[model samples]
Target: MNDRTDAGGNPGPEQPGPEPTGPEHTGQPGQGAADGLARRAAAGFHRTEDGQVDVLRTVGGVRGLAESIVPGVVFLSAFTATQALNPSLVAALAVAAAFTVARLAQRTPLTQALAGLAGVVVCALVARSTGEAKDYYVPGFYTNAAYGTAMLLSIAVRWPFMGLVFGFIRGEGTHWRGDRRRQRAYAAATWAIVAVFAARLAVQLPLYFADQVQALGAARLVMGLPLYAMGLWLAWLISRPVAAAEGPRV
Candidate 1:
């Protein structure tokens, strides 16, 4: 015979080579599928051109300073302006409560709350050292103590509001960008601040004129306006398309 068998122990001509046993043949399709899923997830969280954390840090650094310093001054000035009002404790508590509520509603960051509390302590110490409390509050000891407590609470509550406001503003700018959209949003935010300042002035003028309160409203306005303006400028700068010279590192 020719040493070729079909149904016995001889190899058949139609039998193919052994199936692929390595990743190249077996795992390639699975790897391709996994890679596709990773790409989609990365695309969802990180902007194609910029990292998400980097953007948040940059915006937060700039906006945090603006929000903290400006709002701090405004709140302090408001307290000073209302010093002569009856039930000073009530006024102070009300201001503190408003800030606290706003902050809680917005879920502000913890760092912001601590910073605000520090500011309040500083204000209280300043008021006590300056002898303003002695001058304004009759039976000066008790009144000063009451005022100090109120100031402390007001300061304590500010941190939350600062976090909320800054976060909202930064988030809005981060998630949307168009020259016109940014410009309009910037204008609107600025105008809203202006309106609040204006309303405060209107309410405060009578008290100022009657000599019942100091002219601290102007100081408050001055302190807050620059911050809002600077924030707008910063937003504009960040929103600009990265220059060709800088080349994608941004």
Candidate 2:
């Protein structure tokens, strides 16, 4: 049959208009990178409260990660090599000090470097005082326990620490806590942190008390970064939707 036509035998209305054009919604620049980073970074999913995936706010980059990891690694390696506490402590301390000085000289933020230094110094002092290689990890143990307790208690009181911290940073004050849904979401996120801390204690404390310094160090190393990243992911998962549900109003 002949093609359908108008009364004048012209092409029919079924002929399509020019292909639509303009900014695309799906293939936006950097979208693939954002998606990859969100899913892959630290082997966890991370995003912000705006329902947009991005880097986990908790994780620092390569240099910052190095600052945290290197000193501990040095301590573990030195102790394993020398089978002596003082030399290992000195090695870690020296590495931490070098990081701090490098940060200072570069005029960068001293937070991570100084934190590394303080941690090493405290562990060293503890080991020195206790005369045991294992007690070098004591401060970290108590720290995890304290944080775990505080976060769990905050959840019990219906004021999760994640909510408090996020709100303070956003200048939203305590208002988000007033929303029951948001509060519940934050509480879930807080529970993630509590889990992390609890896991650390459960894994590391036995090794600590057993004087298994190397095993404790290994546990701390494995748990610290990866678990913190997971907590960040949980925060984004639980809290972002709450914020999104509230919409852009506040």
Candidate 3:
């Protein structure tokens, strides 16, 4: 039978379903790499050994939070006070560099620090090239747009991206894709992510186009990590799979 479970709701012998084509589908030839990446991404949600989401660790605790927030704060402050692009950019880069150096000195994993520094450098260069303080946030806009589009496309393909990540978290693996209710739940969660990206553009684009640097900076800060964390929490709540008693059917 094609059902994930037998007619009476007891577990059936595992049988392969028609393989879907997408990053989230385990049927793909690149399934190994894709599953690994999905698991890694899922790990960031801080799913505990007991299946709980650790909000504090998921948001990277206090030090990680500071590293993410402080540079943008410094840049905004410097630009607002001096109205000079170069100094503000330099200050932001300096702060990011300091974080990286501290991470190195402390022998902590440099992944977050190095990534933050790379992002800061990109923003700094973009702003410097345009000689507009507001341009500092442009790269972020593109990033959100790209990620939103990709996730939306995944949903269109019937392989919702959240299912790939959250499935591993829930210990369901790609089998979640076989369950229609689980599929819908995950699709909804992925839409939540798309909404987060869309919200960033909808609110900030006007500010960006009007060249309102300070307000745009504030908006980016408000909408960036904080909004992302909230969205993730909501997704985690909304995407709970159907119970085995109500599991997938043919």
Candidate 4:
């Protein structure tokens, strides 16, 4: 009369009760997928064996830094010195293309270099079409705004983006969400990123509107990698878990 049956319809012993499910259980819905994503995100960072994050590595090291900053520098310098949009665009685009080609020649991953090239191309195209050097920075403004808005939204949902990433980095996983202090700390960290984006907009938008290509480009350089590096470092610092206070040494 037992309902449990084997594949051949033979009577079978009662199956074990459903194993408890969660991050610890293989049957937990999405647990494996989430952990996989977390691992990949952590891998993207350059972490020391002890799990300390290297900011330089996160920004893609020296070559990566050059890839991100050089094209903009080329464009700005070329335009500022010559006051010619066509030549400046060409110079910038050439530098970006050179990076992609070099990565290809080295047989390295093309994701970052290709992306940088694409952005440079888009900016150059926008500037070329509009015939305004300032338009070169137009795409940047919207990009910052969009990122800032997305991070802000993540905080509003109580699932901070940095927390999600840092949680895995620190091996706390999503369990950090249950700790009020950790949650608040990560919220602050996420806010640091939002602030970076906001600062860029606040400083560069006015420059854009005023048609100050040289000043805008200069501001962009100052605020681009260096500012972002500082912000990321600050976030990492802010989100570090505080050690428990020692009790009286009895």
The top-ranked prediction according to TM-score is: 4
Error of 3 at 160 (Å): 0.9
> Any residue pairs clashing in model 4, and if so which?
none
Tens-digit lDDT track of model 3 for 1-250: 0000000000111122122343444456666666665675565455656555555566566675666778889999999999988999999999989999998999987755666677788888898898889888888877777788888999999888888777766656666777688899999999987888888889988999999999988887777666776777788789965456666321
| lDDT accuracy of residue 110 in candidate 4 | 79
For residue 86, model 1's alpha carbon misses the true position, in angstroms, by 9.0
Error of 2 at 92 (Å): 0.2
What local lDDT does model 1 show for residue 199? 38
Clashes of each: 0, 0, 0, 0
lDDT of 4 by residue, 49-141 (tens): 654667776666787678778888999999989999999999999998999899899998776676678778888889899999998888777
Q: For residues 1-250, what per-residue lDDT tens digits would candidate 1 score against the true structure? A: 0000000001111111122233232344354453333333222111213322222232234433343344334444555766542334333334434554565778865343334333334444444555452222112123223433432343354312212222222233112222354444434433333333343344444544454424433333332324333443443343433335546312
Number of the top candidate by lDDT? 4
| lDDT tens readout by residue for model 2, 186-207 | 7887787777777777887889
> 2 or 4: which has the higher TM-score?
4
**Model 2 RMSD in angstroms:** 19.8
Worst 10 residues of 1 by lDDT: 1-10
Error of 1 at 177 (Å): 27
lDDT (0 to 1) per candidate: 0.33, 0.61, 0.71, 0.71
Each model's RMSD to truth, in Å?
Answer: 26.7, 19.8, 10.8, 14.6
Name every residue pair that clashes in candidate 2: none
